[model samples]
Target: MRVLIAGAHGQVGHELLRFAPDGCEVVALGSAELDITNAQQVAKVVERLRPQLIINAAAYTAVDKAESEPERAWAVNRDGIAHLAQTAERLGIPIFHISTDYVFAGDASEPYRETDPTGPTGVYGASKLGGELELVANCSEHIILRTSWVFGAHGNNFVKTMLRLGREREELGVVADQRGCPTSAASIARALWALAVQYREHGSLQWGLYHFSGTPACTWHEFALEIFRQAHALSLLERVPLVRAICTADYPTPATRPAWSVLDCAKLRETLGIAQADWREELAQVLRELA
Candidate 1:
């Protein structure tokens, strides 16, 4: 099958290339190569490639910066996705789009299910939610995968930031109030590829929203401590600095992050017959890659 991956240079996109299923023709493109924001350019590429499946990994993911550049974020995330959905609908091709957990207001006590109401608190989250809605309205054969706390070797993720700060400073302060699962982009890529394969075989199956992430839930502070622990074990860090757990208010940003963005993966696990790996195991793999 022909698979086209947009934002091939991103964290998740890079992992998609690394972990994509074998025996499929994969074409990867970054923003420079195939600008999704430009409808004409997008149409041209889609027309030429004529891919059987399109995986949209491209997105404006500056959570804090989205507050200042809301237009750019909305253009790339929502408008671009709308274009992809419409084009895919026209060509009778399926689209697999990646979304985020920020869509929730983050006040829930338990894990957020697919049916949970989404009232995003930030421009980034709001734009992503808009894209999700557009896909459901415009495209019939579309799969939206909403994930959280994505980290990988290729991009500017929390793991990389923590490692950098842990090496530079004597102390690292991470928010303890914000709770979510740290999903490895490699895992997401693999799961997305599996779902794409399923869609290829059973085109008539229900194609809609699903939540995926690591098994265990953790706060940023805990995740940072784990990163330091693994880094120390791997001899990546010279000395383990004082990792402090602070509240969200202590490190205020322009965007309002969800206090609890944990997503329920029951439907994904049951429907795909897949088991999620523990966060520590996945973290080990990511750290190894970083090393």
Candidate 2:
């Protein structure tokens, strides 16, 4: 299978490049090389590569900044995806995409299924939802994997932030009210490649929306505690900082974060036999790499 990966320098995209399985021909590009927001470039590139499939890791992911820059967010998140989907539709090829858990309103009491009603509270979520709609409208063969709390050895994520703070401060406060699963970039790459391999063997997929996230939900405070614990054990940090549990109201941002970002990934597991990754184990691997 010949695959083209967008957002090649991003957290997930980088892992997709590193963990690409054998027997697959991969061409990955960063935003500078193939700006999806530019329709002409997208058309030209797809024409040149003629990839069997396109896995789009590109996204405008500045959650708080998106509140002040809705137009920019929509341009990249919605319009950019529309270009990719349309090009894929024209070529009669499949397109796989990454989406966020923020598409749901923060009010859900239980884990959200793929069919759950979406009500985005922030500009970033609204823009991503727009992209999802555009992809569905444009492409017949597509899979949208809505994930949450993605972190990796590369890129700026909550894990890196907590590590930096752990080194700088003796104590810190984290929002305990918010809950979500912390998925690693490598795990997501593995899932996507599994789907790619299945499609290559079968020539088609049971393609649609599916939720893929890490196992066992926890609060940000709890996530931070684990990061410090692991980092200290790995000698990545000299000492573990005290993480104080606090309400969301204590820390304000321009955009409202979804309180419930846990996704029920049973559908993917049952259909594709891809199990939810245990984030604790993934975190250890990441910490070891960082150390």
Candidate 3:
């Protein structure tokens, strides 16, 4: 099978490249090589490669910055995805695009389900939601995976940022009100590869949006404290600070984040027969690698 991965240099993309699945010829492309926002470039690449599967990991991920740069965010997140989906349709290929839990308004009492209505609080979320709509509309064979709080070995994720900051500061302030799962990019890559293989074997199955993340949910403060604790235990840090809890209003950003962005993984678990790893266990693996 021929698989073409966009944003191959990103956190999840890099991990996917490192953990390339068996029995597949993987062609990875970074933004410099193939700017997804350029429809002509996308069309040219897809036309030449004619890949059976296209897994898009490219995105404009600056959450707070997106508020001031909505156009830029939409270019890559919304319009870029439309281009990929359209090109996939032209080649009669399937696309596996990554999305986010920010599609929800963050007011849900429980985990957000696939069938729930989306009310994005910021431009970033709205752009991703736009991408989802485009993918569903433009292509019949596509998989939209909505995940949250993604972290791993590569990229500027919260896990890495906290590790760096914890070393310099005696105390840290993290937003405690916002609650969601910390999804490992490695796990997300594995799930994407699995879904790609399954789609190849069973083309008749339904193709649409699905939510996947770590099993247990946690606040940003709790997550930070856990990271510091594990880092200290592993000797990765000299001392772990008392990570103070703060509300969303305490530290304001240009983007309005959803208060709760936890996604329900019941459909993903049941349909794919996949189970999510615990958040701490996932974080431990990441830290071990960093160490």
Candidate 4:
């Protein structure tokens, strides 16, 4: 089966290229090669490739900056996805669109489920929600996977930022009030590849919105502490900095983050027989790679 992946240079996209199943033809394209916002280019490329499946990992993911640049966020997150979904539907190909956990209001006491009501608090979340709606409306053969707090060996992520800060400063403040699971891009890539292979073999899919994140939700403060712990163990850090736990009110940002953005992955597990990875294990691997 031929698989075309957009946003090939991103964390999850890069992992997808590395972990994709053998014997499958994979065409990975970064933004410079094929911008999803360009409708004509998307149509032309999809037509030329005629891939059996398309995985869209492209997104405008600057959460804080999105507050100041709503247009750019909407263009890539919503309109760009619309173009891909439309083109995929036209060519009778299935699409796997990556979404975020921000679509929820973060008010839920428990983990957010796939059927939860969406109330995005910021432009980034709203635009991603728009992208989800666009995909649902445009294509029937599409699976929208909503993940949270993604990190990996490649790209700019919270793990990398914390590592850099840990190396530079004596102390750092992390918001303890916010909570979510930290998913590994490698795990997400493997799961998506499994779904793609299943679809190709069976010629059918249980397509719809699903949630998949790492096991054991944690706050930014806790996550930072773990990073320091692992880095220190790996001898990657000369001096482990102090991570002070602070409330969300202590540090203000352009965008308001979800106070509780953990997602329940039971649906994906039940449907696809996929299990969530232990984030601590993944974190150790990531730290070792950095080391």
- Write out the backbone clash pairs for model 2: none
Q: Arrange candidates by lDDT, descending.
A: 2, 4, 3, 1
Question: Candidate 2, residues 1-291: lDDT per residue as tens digits?
Answer: 899999989999999998999999999999999999999999999999999999999999999999999999999999999999999999998999999999999799899999899999999999999999999999999999999999999999999999999999999999999999999999999999999999999999999999999988999999999999999988999999889999999999999999988899999999988899999999999988887
Best by lDDT: 2
Where model 2 places Cα greater than 4 Å from the true spot, the runs are none
Model 2: what TM-score? 0.99
Superposition error at 95 for model 4 (Å): 0.3
lDDT of 1 at 238: 92
Candidate 1 residues 1-291, lDDT tens each?
A: 899999999999999998778777899999999998999898889989999999999999999999999999999999999988888899988899999999999999999999999999999999999999999999998889999999887889988998999899998778999899999988899888888777667765467899999979999999999999999999889999999889999998999899998999998888775466687888898889889
TM-score of 4: 0.99
lDDT of 1: 0.90
Encode model 4's per-residue lDDT on 158-268: one tens digit a residue: 999998998899999999999999999999998899899889889989999999999899999999999999898889898899899999999999899999989999999
Candidate 4's error at 278, in angstroms? 0.6
Better of 2 and 3 by lDDT: 2
Better of 1 and 3 by lDDT: 3
Top candidate by TM-score: 2
The estimated TM-scores of all candidates read: 0.98, 0.99, 0.98, 0.99
- Please report, as a residue range, the 10-residue window in candidate 3 with the lowest summed lDDT: 197-206
Tens-digit lDDT string for candidate 3 (68-146): 9899999999999999999999889989899999988999988899999999989999999999999999999988899
- Candidate 1 stretches with Cα past 4 Å from truth are none
Whole-model Cα lDDT of every candidate shown, in order? 0.90, 0.95, 0.91, 0.94
The worst-scoring run of ten residues by lDDT in candidate 1 lies at 197-206
